[model samples]
Target: MKKIILSLLVLVLAASCQEQQKIAFVDNGQVIEDYQMKIDMEAKFKKQDEAYKRKTDSIGQAYQLDAQQTQLKLSSLSQKKQQEGSQQFSQKWQLIQQQLQYEQQQMEQAFSKEMDSVIKSVNKFVEGYGEKNGYTFILGKNAAGSVMFGKEEKDISEAVTKAINDDYNGKDSKEDATETTEKEEDK
Candidate 1:
């Protein structure tokens, strides 16, 4: 009886001493905001957006100028000629409007697709970081509250951000090195 009690106590103690599963939470919003890749991507998109706006505005101005010229000419023309000029201007205006709308829709769809790809890349990087760091679970704490309240120590957003930034920097360095090599070869 004594020996059996000692054996059970030893088994219980051994089981209790086993390591606990590692879990951490990341502030998704903070990670996204501070991520270097995201920052660069957003800047690129902003520039592209400005260029698109300029192009659209230029096209609109051209249409406006054309309409104004047509109006001015119509006032001095005979009735039959005025009617013919009005119909031609109306058709041209409608076609321009349709083309502008189509271009806007296409730009929106392309932008949306590119943004989605960037978001997915970020998520994949986070997942890979968690796995490589031996985290059993890495919960994302966003505004939606997927993780309600994690202890400060268990929040790994900074570490994850650093890891991602380092990875991005490494890639950039490699590209720079490759470009330098190509230039040297050209020389």
Candidate 2:
């Protein structure tokens, strides 16, 4: 009975050691920002942003010119007519400003929504990669503030960036293999 109990204790101790996990840390922010796909997205956004700004500026300049013309015409009117024209001009100006503000807000919201979708897709790819590679825990840079201590080897930033870019580029492992097999079969 003592021998049997000793054997069971040894087995439990061995199992406990075997269950120890390997952990890796990554700077997820750096990975995302430095990713090739993310850079392209940023460039696209900047291009669209410049175009939007140009359009907004043109509208603003036209509005200002129209308002100036209305003001110029105000001096030629009777007092009662002048008051009514001034009030109408105020209302129109307010409405135009409000509309511009709302349009800018809508553009920002739309950009945010699209960025959220892209980030979610990147996260899903990371999760799938971790699972396939048997990683017990893949910690983000913010996980424990351990990534900012200047340990270059501990940083998996490049790997995460490459993985994300590769995923975004649709270089799927199985798809590539299947395509190769099909080509060979065709030949």
Measured by lDDT, the strongest candidate is 1
Candidate 2 lDDT, 73-177, residue by residue in tens: 998999999999999988987897888789788878877887787677667766775665455766777555755564555455566566667667776654543
Error of 1 at 157 (Å): 1.0
lDDT of 2: 0.71
Q: Candidate 1, overall lDDT? A: 0.78
Give me the displacement of residue 57 in model 1, in angstroms.
2.2
Tell me the whole-model lDDT of each prediction, alpha carbons only.
0.78, 0.71
- Cα deviation at 160, candidate 2, in Å, is 1.7
Alpha-carbon deviation at 26 in model 1, angstroms: 1.0
Q: Model 2: clashing residue pairs?
A: none
**Candidate of highest TM-score:** 2
